[model samples]
Target: MEKMTLSSKTREAQSPTEKWMRYLGFPGGILLFLLILFLPPGAGLSASAQSGAACFALALVWWVTEPFPTYVTSLVLMFLLLVTRTSNAKAIMDVLGMEVIWLNLLAFILSSMLVKTRLAKRMALWLVVRFGHKATWALLAFLVLQLVLAPLIPATAARCVMTLPLMIVVATIYGSTEATPNAFGKNLMLLNLACISVLSSITMTGSSANLIAVGLIQNMGGHRVYYMDWMRVGAPVAILTMVLMWILGQKLLFRMKPGEQVPQVEGGLDLVRRQYEAMGPLGFQEKKAIAIFGLVLFLWMTDIFHMRWFGVEISAPFAALLGAVIVLFPRWGILSWAEADIPWHLLIFSAGAYAGGLALDDTGAAEWGVRMLFGGMNLKGVPFGLTYTVVVSVMMYSHLLTTSKTVRTLIMIPIIISLAKALGWNPLSLALPAALCIDWVVGLPISGKPNVVLFSTNQFTVSDNFKYGMMTCTIGVLILVLSGATWFHWLGITPSFWAVAP
Candidate 1:
C-alpha cells in the first residue's frame, strides 16, 4: 500500500544514529531486564524483590529509549509486573483511581476550557501587546506569560503550542527566521523553552509530575504535602531559578548584537497589535472561562484555610472537578466530552509508572536497593548538607538522561524516600527539594514535550539549547544548594549546616 511505502521512506530518511538507537531500544530493554533479574540476591532483596527491581530496570531502559510510544511502553511494564508476579492486577488497577491521576485528568479538561475559549491565546497576546516592543521586554513578556499559564494549564506542551506562533512573530520582528537565525531568536525561543518547564515548579498543580511527587510523599513517605507547604518551598526556589536563567541567558549565553538588539521590521509590532485587535473584545466564553478557572485557583490557593472557614477542605481534584463540571454542563458549558482534549495516553502512562513505583514500595524492593546502594556509599558519617546537595544534583541533572518527568519522579522519589529512611533523615528534606527540580527539563530538544514543540521552529540549534540549559542548570543547582543551607533550613525542610547524620 501507499502508506507502507511512505512509512518505509520515512524510516529511510532518518539519520544513521537515530536509526540505530531506535532499532536497539527493544533489545536494550530486554537485556537490562535479564541482567538485573539474575544479579546475585545479596543482603538487599528477596527473590520477588529482585524480580521487581528487574521490571523497574527494564521500564527505565524502554522509557528513556522509547522503542514504542511511552504509554505503550508503560502498558508493557504493567503487564510484565503482573506476569512476573511482582504485583497483583487489582493493585495495578487501583493506581489509576488515585487522587493524583484524577487531578491530572481534571486539570487537562479545565485546560481544554481555556483553549476552546481562546483565553490562553488572549492572555499571551495582551502581554505581548503590553510589553513586547523591545527585544528585552519581549523575552521577559513570554517568561511572565509562562509563569501565569503554568498553574492554569497543566500541560506544558499545550502552553508551548499556544505561544509558539507568537514566538515566531517576535523572532521575525528581530530579523531571524528558520533560514536566517540570530541570537535574538535563540534567546527568545530558548527562554520560553526553559521558563515553560522551570516555572511549572512554582505551583503544585503546574504539572502532573509535581502532583505525582506530592502523591508519592503521602503514599510512600507517609506524610501529606499540602499545597501551601509545597508553595512555600517551591515558589522562591523556582522564581530565583527563572530570574537567574533570564539574566545569565541574555547576558552571557546568547548575547545580542547591536543590529539584533531592536526590532528590525518596522510594521511587525503593528502586525501583533492587529492580531490582538482581530479578536475584538473578550467574548462571553472568555469571561466565563476566566470565572470558572478563577474559582478553581481560589480554592486551590485557600486549601489550607478551607478547614477553618468551611468546616471541611476542598481537595485539589475536587476543586478542579468543580470547574470541569461548569465547563461540561450542557449548553452552559464551553466544551463537550470529545472536545476536552484530555490525553488518555499520558494518563495511562502515569498510571503505569505509578503502579510500578507502588509495586516496588509494597514488595520492599526500593528499600532493599537503596540500602544495598547507600550502605556501600558510607553516607552515615556524611553531613546532611553534602547528601542533600548530591540528591538534588542527581535529580536536577537526571532529566538529561530520561525524557519523561513522570518517570523521573516515579523512579527517584520512592528511592529518595527510602534513602532518607536508611539515613535517619526526614524524607521531605531530600524528596521535596528534589521534587521541585522535576519540572526543570530544559537541557535537550528531547528533554521535554515543551522543548520539542519550541525546537520545531528550527530557530535555535541543539548546541544553543545545551549551552543555555547547562548554564541555567548549574545556576539552579547552586541556588538550590544555597537554599538548602539557608532558606530551606529556616523553613525546617532541611537541617542546619554542620550537622552530620547518624
Candidate 2:
C-alpha cells in the first residue's frame, strides 16, 4: 500500500513538468510564424498584397512542419505561383534547375558509392593505424582525416555516421574518463570535425550553401560565382579557422599527459591487417570502382582547366550518374541496386527548401521582409556596421534553437536576405557569416549529429558540453566577426544598401 502510494505521488509530481516542457518545446518557431503573419508590410507589399499573403501562408506552413515531401512541396509552390499569376511556371521552375542542387544530388550518390565500396573505411583505417597510438594525437589525426573527407562527403550527418563508430573504438582504447577525459576528447573531436567541415564548405563546390549563396548573388546582384573565385575567398578563411580550432583545443580543452604512450587500441592495426590479408589482393571489381571514383573526382575538379580537351563540363550530377552506372554494371556488380538504400527523403527535403525560396521570391515576400529589417539604415560609420553586426553575432547564439543546422539554414536564409535588403546591405555579407556561424553549435550534446553520436556513449552529459562549448563558441564568434569585417573590406564590398554620397 505504501509502495503504491509512493508511485502515485511520483507520477503526479512529474506530470506538470512534462506538460511544461512539451509546451515550451516549439514556442520560438510558433512565435516567429505569428510575427510574420501579424507584422505590417515594409517592402511594396501593399501593392501586391495578395501575392504577399500567399508567400507568408506558404512560409508559415513550411516553417511549421512538412505535411508532404520537400520536393513535392516545391512542386506545389511552383504550381501555386503559376495559378496565382505571381510568376509564370517557367520562372518558378528556373530556380529548381540550379546547378547547386544537382551538385548536392551527385555528391550524395558518390558518397553512397564510397560507403558501398568500403573505400571510406579503408582510408580511415589506413590513417588511424598510423596515428592511433597517442590519445591527443589520435584526436588530431581524426580531425585531419575528416577534413580531407569533408569536401567529398557533403552531408555532415553522413560524415558523422562514417566517423563516429571509429571514434568510439578509439575512446574505449584511451580509457578516458567520461567526466573529463573521455567527455572532453569525444566532444572536441566531433565539434572540431563538424565545425571545420562547415568552414571548408564556403568554397562553391564544397557545400550546397556555397552554391546557393553564389546563385543568390547572381540573381540579386548580377554577379556570377566561379569555382576558383570561391576558392580564393573561402580557402584562406578555412585554413585560418582550422588552425585556430586545433591550437585552442590542444592548449585548453584536450590535455596530454607528459611522456604517455599512445593508448593501446583494441582490434587496431592487427584487425585491419588481418582483414586486408584475407582479401589477398584487390578484386577486379574493387579496382574498377576505385578507378571510377578517382577519375570522377579528378575530372570534376580539373574540368575548368581542361574543358576543351575533356569536351564537356563534368558536373557533380553527371559524375554521380557515371558512378552509379559503374556500381551496378553487370560486369562490376559491386553492389546490386537493391543493396543501395539511398535516403530519398533527404533529397526531397532539400528540394522543398529550394521551392520555398522560389515562392518567397515570386510573392515578393523576401523583399518585404528585407525592407522591414534594414530600410533607411545608414551604414556609413562603424556603429552602423556594428548594428548589423548584432544579427551576425546572434546567429551564433541561435544554434541553440535547433538540432539540425541545415533546418536552421533553410529557415534563416530567406529572412536574412530580406533583412539585408532592408538594411541596404549586401545579403552575402550578412547571410554567409550568419550561415557559417550556425556551425558554432558546440554548446549541447543534442546540438548536432556528431555531438549526439558521441553522446550516445553515455560518457558526456549536457552540462559538460555546455560549459566547454559555450566558451568555444564565444571565442569563435569574436574571431568570425573580426575576420568577416576584414574579408568584406578586402572583397571591395560595403554593407550599406545605398552608396554614401562622395
**lDDT computed for candidate 1:** 0.76
lDDT of 1 by residue, 428-470 (tens): 8999998999999888765776665465465775557877888
Q: In model 2, how many backbone clashes occur?
A: 10
Enumerate residue pairs that collide in model 1: none
| Residues 130-222, model 2: lDDT tens digits | 775445566677667666766665545445544543454455445543333443354445455445445544556665555665566566645
Give the lowest summed-lDDT range of ten residues in model 1.
Answer: 1-10
Candidate 2, residue 279: Cα displacement in angstroms equals 5.1
- Cα error, candidate 1, residue 461 (Å): 16
Question: Candidate 1: TM-score?
Answer: 0.64
Best by TM-score: 1
